[model samples]
Target chain A: MAPIRTAIIGLSSTATTSWASAAHLPYLLSARGRAKYQIVALCNSSVESAKRAIEVFKLPPETKAYGNPQDVADDKDIDLVVVSTRVDVHYETALPSVKAGKQVFVEWPLAHDVAHAKELVDAARVAGGRTLVGNQGREAPPIVKVKQLLEQGSIGKVFSSEVRAFGGTVDREALLPGLKYFTDRAIGGNIVTIGVGHLFDQVQYVIGEFQNIQSQLQLQRPNVLLRDPSTKKVVETVKSNVPDLIIIDGTLAASQIATDGANVLFRFRRGQQFPGDPALSWTINGEKGEIRLQAFGGSSLHAGSYGAPVTIEVHDFASDQVQKSEWSWQSWQEELAIVGRSVGVLYDKFAEGEFEGAPSFETALVRHEQLATVLAGWDEK
Target chain B: MAPIRTAIIGLSSTATTSWASAAHLPYLLSARGRAKYQIVALCNSSVESAKRAIEVFKLPPETKAYGNPQDVADDKDIDLVVVSTRVDVHYETALPSVKAGKQVFVEWPLAHDVAHAKELVDAARVAGGRTLVGNQGREAPPIVKVKQLLEQGSIGKVFSSEVRAFGGTVDREALLPGLKYFTDRAIGGNIVTIGVGHLFDQVQYVIGEFQNIQSQLQLQRPNVLLRDPSTKKVVETVKSNVPDLIIIDGTLAASQIATDGANVLFRFRRGQQFPGDPALSWTINGEKGEIRLQAFGGSSLHAGSYGAPVTIEVHDFASDQVQKSEWSWQSWQEELAIVGRSVGVLYDKFAEGEFEGAPSFETALVRHEQLATVLAGWDEK
Candidate 1:
């Protein structure tokens, strides 16, 4: 099968380095199996930025650069549109692509608000274009193993689940640039919408739907030090209206007629210490056995220092023993080996132009709804 | 120094086997630094049970047996009274000794209700006697190491925490005969009081005070099979009034006067499977590094069965590495080694008859109050 030609919209940090450089370009250039893909175009709000990304990532000389999202979406040769723009632009970028009958893969939050996310979901459904949201953890191998173990009754009927994802502040100046959307409530930039939204998608994707939710959101650090990009000096103070921390407590009602009696306790925080951060830990208890995933990665503040390797601990009751698996990813290749397998499935679906019944977009909207509810509550508080 | 004579107030399953036989007796009898403490008397509600325990544990032939709690409490030769009775009798049996100025070590949930617990705490305070609540996890080595690491700023400023403890049902017949008090609203024997209460004590003891709390409780299993003890036959059905599961999302207000933020997420459930149960999984994320502890023992149903050893994983950013510690009987002994050092100080106090403030009774009552608030909310639901 011919490789699915892809283009990235929104030339952000994740677009320039993380998604385009680390994940998409490499996966597109080297992916094996029936679902090979390639990056053929680059799109950003500015023509100069698009040209820089093309040059920096060494895209093929024939690959085109577009200043507007519609130009890339309207391109006839593009099979997939990857949106790694600011949270506010996700809907604007992906909506055109969905309408153009091209597959869409948007970074987490899917859209800045629930209304926009709902609109994108609706558009994609009507257009019959496949959609994928960047809930990367759900695509990781450890998560796949967890899903398999739950199916095999490794922990019995899962009665409860606890998930936490916490870290210090993101380098806002380096990442956000002219876009202060992360600190702006109007733009839906906050820990709850971005970080928690990403994690909630993985939680529901792995466990099931959350029936009801009661949450507390707090903007822990109101005054953030914004640094000058060139000199790395404190340039100004950015006032953050969005919540830096979010906690939710609720029950997972019986999904598909299986009242497994599960309760969820989740928390996500920012500007907090990253090491020994409990918010990054997760444990799922079932009737047969339990599974735990401990996150111990280093902080980005210290350059590219690696955190602790992800460890999988499984308890087998009948044998009265515990088994463990540990994997190390010192390079992009190793990390890709874990992320590629699952993301590849969605890519294949997108390449075939079969996106009407995809679960990813709906799942992403559910996460956005949860984030909106949390953010709305924060505003009220 | 003369040996501190000890007497048991309840000779039940946990007392006769695990605590008295496996833990206390061997430690008291063979301990190198514990030669000053001797098992002088054994007592239960029934003299027959007391005699059986004495003989089975190979206590001195002159060891007296008593069927009355007051008899054991007032025994002049007894220096320390170990109360391991049902939650109902805890206040009744231990209060007299506490009032008599005898040292006391009572099992968890100091009393059945918050009011009774308060009375005991008040009595112990007025008596000016030393008391120890059997929240042994505080004394566990892994927990001790975590405390040490935190004190050394291993994880930096702790900003958030996630703790999960769940497992399959306890042998309802074997472990819960006295658990009727747990199911009765009047007695406060629900998961909030017993399970979450026990966990809260350990967490608060380690982390500090919880300034406020909000929780959701669920009676997932409304009916349970009541089995006959002797013949192991189905006796009758018992309607459950208390929740088998609980989820709590709250903040432990920064008590350290430090310039940082923190959040805590805790969960407890009954239907969780065993063997591979993440026994007492906890993570504390601070500014410097993250410390994670994964307790590997199964639930109460499968504890100490042929299962994986409980382990603690520590990821110190200062070191840029992860370290793991395993649990074993030897590990328990190492824990005792530290407890033994404290015991040495305790023995000196015993000899001088100079009791330190008995604050545990009050602490237990505070916990009971928290439980009452949770239970009252559960009832309203």
Candidate 2:
């Protein structure tokens, strides 16, 4: 019944604020997470930083400090290794842990490329290591509700679906210093593999997986203005080859068998401005009625759809009533930071020894392969 | 400048309530209509019935009663002839007026067949007579608003669009007695030609017309149950050969030339059960943002999308606001009936000599030809 002993790479000290420091650490330190996970070691780019992390985050004196990922992965006391680093460094940091036979959780854009991601998947499989990636889609409460309703036939034989959303990746006027490399499509980290990939996974998770699909990707906005972090002024206009627009039209396998056959029309744009933003609108049209999810502001398909105030509306012909889904996330909200509540749910699943479909390294590998196919198909026409 | 003198063929008296009586008569009798149109004649199955119509409807003493459509069409004082009869008889009732050089308004499904509709178009063109058919789509206020918004670049460069709705036909339990003959597709008055035809016209009206398209039609519901007039009980079940489901995917010429092409995914289902009714949900995904129309009740593609309570929502990325269209129908709603208000708008268009897109016979012929293509294509696939 002891908690899973854990070590985290790129663990910044409390003196600095970062995604790793803000999103998962607080949850792990909370009452519910406290009973389930125990931090046993820390690794930073250097030993000085790792030592400072122990003091700043106030970890136990016995907790080891390591300067590199391999040292942390080699520690005998650690049962799980967590990698929280830049996309370019994910392979180097996570590969060691997979080889060490420790359960690992890596944040997404699973790796720099399919080759690196494949290496990680192969290592984990050979070592029989448990894995998790931060896909965090199935954990969203609204997604869960929608999936349940569809399975229960709330709309009665769904025939078609449509979605129009913003990936929020091309917010050119609002880029942080660290995101400059992300704009380079060469990094394999644009909206397609990151922002939209999360949403796409959710679509496949909620609706059935796509049996056949054809897609068009367009980089409509050629030049993007990067804002200065301190002065908040446009400093540089970067040429972006990464696609800001994605259009997909294909039939769902479920609908293909029905005499009427159902399909999907999905459009995800990049850099949705606030005033003119239609955050996310998805509709499942069925034989009896429809279930619609319209998020008014900042609602992305990935983690953002679970943010407070996401709306789920159902117009049921059988019941002859339009109803809004009712849900609660008090526990999640209590422990939440800027990161979404689904991460906590992710932690809970990992704690319960559940790994399937929870963004495991294997899941990320399959998604990476799908992304390669989409990128390849975009050039066919 | 004088009020357009009008004669109505098959105009039922107030002793019997019909679609014309409930939807148009009230509007025509209103003060605004009184100043613009003068009813000069009425035609019925017989002279006695015509006399009863005059007495029951309380027409002015100047109004003449006739036993046949030919007599009404031949009247020198009648500048316009309105035909409100069964589909099988539309050609017979309106053909004389076309030859007589009177501006004529005929109910939808302009004729029992495409050949007949083409004949009417040809006859009207040769006679140089204005003609209106009851497509009644552009006349709907919401449709007009959507078209105006799209034209104004409300959602810039619409690259993709989707619509999932029902034809509202094959609603075995919701049919009235007069619609009994419509169940027979051989008459060319079924959902494919009527329900979906109305919606398809509206789609083209808002977006640019489809430059190229293909379709699939299915007779999903093979049999329909008819309800009794007096008891509202299932009185009989009849076999149906007409298709109640239509699926179309095609590119709008607008998107084909743009870097990101705009396309449409449309599905019209039949026999949608209610309390779970999903009548209509349309999403136009563009470069700037999206405009969505979601109807709760019987919001089919035809006249239903323009009903007062129909919801039109817009997320304009340019404006940075998600908004619901604020529209008023004071002119039409003031004359609203238990049926709907679109009919009054249709009447207004006919009276004002605005024949361009107000469901003109030419437009109806085009739609009929389009329907023929769809039926032919359905067989091909």
Candidate 3:
């Protein structure tokens, strides 16, 4: 029962702004994570970058430094490989780890697109590799509470649900230098695929998978300016093909329990939320009641990341009363970085052999395929 | 303009319970309405019923009583005919009035089916008759403000809009004796056609018509109990084929100004609003700002009907400020019944010959056709 040795790819040094540093490191470096997981290696685009990250983050001196995904995959001591890079590089890194029979964890999107995601899923199955996809929504407190309420019939039979949300954290009119590549659709990491995709996964995870979907994706904002944060000067204006607005309506897959194919209506607009309102407003309508989740600052339900505060309420039809739902996270989660709390919960579940409760590569494949269909349909349009 | 002598068909005497009495009589009997309209005749299923209504409502002794629609339509002294009966009778009553070349006003739904609605539209066109459809949403104060703001570019170029609404006033588990017929799909006066239909017209009035629509209509509550209100006793349990849940998403018709084919997502559920929440929540997302309208207590946007209070706010992205919108109604409208405010406005517009500002039979046809398409698709499924 030795701690599982882990190697993290693309673990950046800039803790103030980097996703991997801010979201992943805080949890893995914590006492709870220390007892369950041991950092064995760091992988970057080059050996120098890997060594620099190790030095800047003050990792153990014996931690192996690797220049590429293959080098990390070949490290016999590493029991787990975590792919924490741009979505476009997900398949390149995770596929090698899966083929090498290491437990793999890839940040959501699974890969740049469906074809690559499918290949990784196929590779994992062939190698009999246990895998996890970084869709933290599966462990988010509000999402978990909603799912439990639904299963317990707190709302009776859900007939329909609707979500109106602000989709992106980036300023509507511009972006910062390091984040400018987010405006490019080709990287497969724009708002539609990553930001909205996460929210969509949360919806399906709470209720059920969509049986059929019809969507309209609009490139409402086609040109975006990239500026330097310190100088506050525009460096470049880039053309964007990604859609800033998305409207989807569909029916949930039918279930054995009382005509469970509920209707769904979702709309997401890129940019900040309206001045005084929550960024995310979701309502699940049922025969005997309703459950509403409102996140004030950020629409993406990555727990409290993006500085959003969430409130969950259930309105029971018979009693004509609305009750606030109370949920709790591990005390250690509060000690981790805000963005890393859900990740920490996820890691805890993984350590306790709660694989079924977490989303696997196959789970990621379903979401990835749904998004791929949406994007493909938009391209055809 | 000698008060456009009018004949009202099916003006029920049950002022506290009847739609025509509660919604129409209050306005028509008012001082302002009296100055523009004079009741020349009363039409009902029987001449005795018509006489009873006129007597109970205390109309002038000279008011003629008629047994059928043809009797009112044939009266040369009558210049206007108002049909306020059930949906199934709309075509029968309004058709003869249109063919007789008298201005006609029909409560919304227009007819029981699309073919009947089409015939009425064609008949009105061929007869050169002026017609009004009782869609009061066109004149609701909040709707007026939203429309005005959109026209004035208060929210900039609109990219998308979302509406989540409670679609019916009836209790989810049961219905009253007088309203039991509403559960019958064959009558075509259920939540889908009347409740949700009214809200749909309000959306299209502010934005443009849907260019393409995808909808899922569900009859989640198939067997609803009918009860006697006073005794709280179950009268009957009837099977309902009508949809109690509806989800629609689509793209607006293309416009010349700033790629104006905005995305729309709409969801409506029958029965009461969730406790402590507004029955209707609408958001129009734009480039520079967002406009939100929230109606508490009732979902139907018939001004203050159903005792719902509405608030309209605009969030300017540039200023990051939320501003409440102010709108006004005619002074005389305050004296009418609560549910009759918007109806009073519509009547005022019609009397002023401001036909463009009021919804005509042609306008109702477009809404009816859209709903027809939705119902047809659901039936096919």
Candidate 4:
């Protein structure tokens, strides 16, 4: 199958070094016997940053270095645009691409707030462009297994779920010299907007739609110690309005009526500085069984090890027995590698006419709408 | 101090075997140097049950037996009335005693609904009688340790709290026989009104008052199997309307600012026949440190030896260290024994005048009001 010519907006480190280079690029470039994609252009506010990212990520030598999002969006060679930019610029960068009739995959949190997200979703619909926001968790192996188990009645009916994700504070000292906007509440820096936002999307994707939400968002440390990116010295203090901690309780309508109901309790907080622990743990309970995931905060999956093994247990009602399984992902790279493999499978399915008539655009739009609602709550003063 | 003459109303097995013999009688009769109470009478729906309780608990020869609550309340020597009757009879048995100027300690729920509870509180207030409804958890040892830690700034300025308590269905067979009222929603049989009620009381006692609550309550199982008490046979089926699971997201007033806002998430559920595991866990986050308690439920705490341990870890900012503690209570009886020792100390302090004129009754009434508000939400159709 012909490769889907792809372009990327925003030449930040995450774009060049994180998901873009590690997961997206590898999956797009290496899926044998599957529909292929090629990165043909890179865009940034300055051509220099684009050129730097192109060199760092080893894009084709002929790839264009565009100075702005519109320049890349106007290129007819690009069939898909991947937006990995500052959350504040998501709508601005992605809207042009969607309007120009290209498929789009923006990172989690389509916009800083619901209104802008809705605007982007509406534009994609009118332009008839497919959208895929980066809630890559939907492709995770454990989640995929959980979904299959639910479909097969492994856990009779999922009545409730609890998810927790915590990590030490993101090291601001690591960002570029002038990228403080990422830490600003006005630009969406907090557990509610970023962490739980992704979790809710994943859970909703598997179970169903959320009917309502009641949440308590907290700014645990209002004043954060800022440090210089170059010297790593205390620079200044920035006031934070975004919640470092969030707790949400809500219901999800299950597909089957025999299933009692779905209850979700989620908590996310800034990581603790204490030793011997990473920050994330999740548990999902259905009528038949439960699955739990614990991840330590870091770019590495191994960081979450509590000197104990990670295990999954299943209860079989028919046999009246419980079964257990264990597997290890040595690093965050490995975890992302698993997700990347799944994306390849999806792409292969798409090429084999499996999704030729699938409602990819409509399904993605539904996810976008929910993301908007979360942002609306997040942006409340 | 001279012992205050006391009487027990409702001579059930829990009262005759557990409360009367194991807790109240032993404490009242042999609590030397700290014993400030004595049994004066025993009351039940019938003289036969009262006499049988008197025999089983080995009451003093002078202690009288009464079939009517008013008969006990009319006795000038009866200074305190312990209402350990079925929930439906709590108001009937305790109201007259409180109105008759007797201190009353009623078993929990206060009444079937908030309205009845409010009436009891008002009657006690009007008659100048002290009331301590049986939320004995408020006096538990571990809880006391937690409270002392918070008070002493072991973990400074609590900002968030997560609490979960769950268990298999309360033996409907054990509780429903001869108590048709147990199956009625108006009588408050299921999880939310009963189990979470106890949890909320304990939480409020330790934390403070909730400012608002958003909750989802569900009756997961529509029909529950009922068995014959004497024969131990499956004899019937009972319909359940009250929620088997309850989840709430709330904001609480800080112990300091009265409005310093603490975020709270709480969940209580019946043991799922399939997917659910019986468990209880709590975590509290403060400005300086965090404390976590996990694995807190089951018939025999040791019944699920394969489960995780109950752990308490504290991170102290002043010391720049994290400390850990763990203990196992093989049964609920052992857990209650730990509770008894803690309350015994408080009772000793009270008798020694450590809390002289401390307005303990007023503070207790305030807690009762909070419970009332929580129950009012559940009362809504």
Using DockQ as the measure, the top candidate is: 3
Fnat of each candidate: 0.27, 0.09, 0.68, 0.41
**All candidates: DockQ:** 0.20, 0.13, 0.64, 0.39
lDDT of 4 by residue, A52-115 (tens): 8888877778988988888877888888788877678888988888888788878767777666
Question: Count of backbone clashes for each model?
Answer: 31, 21, 0, 10
Q: After TM-score superposition, what is the CA distance of residue B39 in candidate 4 from its true location, in Å?
A: 1.9
Ranking of all predicted structures according to lDDT, beginning with the best and ending with the worst: 3, 2, 1, 4
Cand 3, B chain, TM: 0.96
Q: What Cα-based lDDT does every candidate model obtain?
A: 0.64, 0.73, 0.83, 0.62
TM-score of 2: 0.75
Best by TM-score: 3
Selected candidate, larger DockQ, 3 vs 4: 3
Residue-level lDDT for A321 in candidate 3: 88
> In candidate 1, what are the lDDT values of residues A256-310, reduced to their tens digit?
3225546777766664343354325677755445677765662221112134555
Two-way lDDT contest, 2 vs 4, winner: 2
Better of 3 and 4 by TM-score: 3
Sorted into a CAPRI-style docking class, model 2 comes out as incorrect
Ranking by TM-score: 3, 4, 2, 1
After aligning candidate 2 to the native by TM-score, how far in Å is the CA of A312 from where it should be? 5.4
- Distance from true position, residue A246, model 2, in Å? 4.5
Question: Candidate 3, residues B288-328: lDDT per residue as tens digits?
Answer: 88899988868877744447568889999888889999776
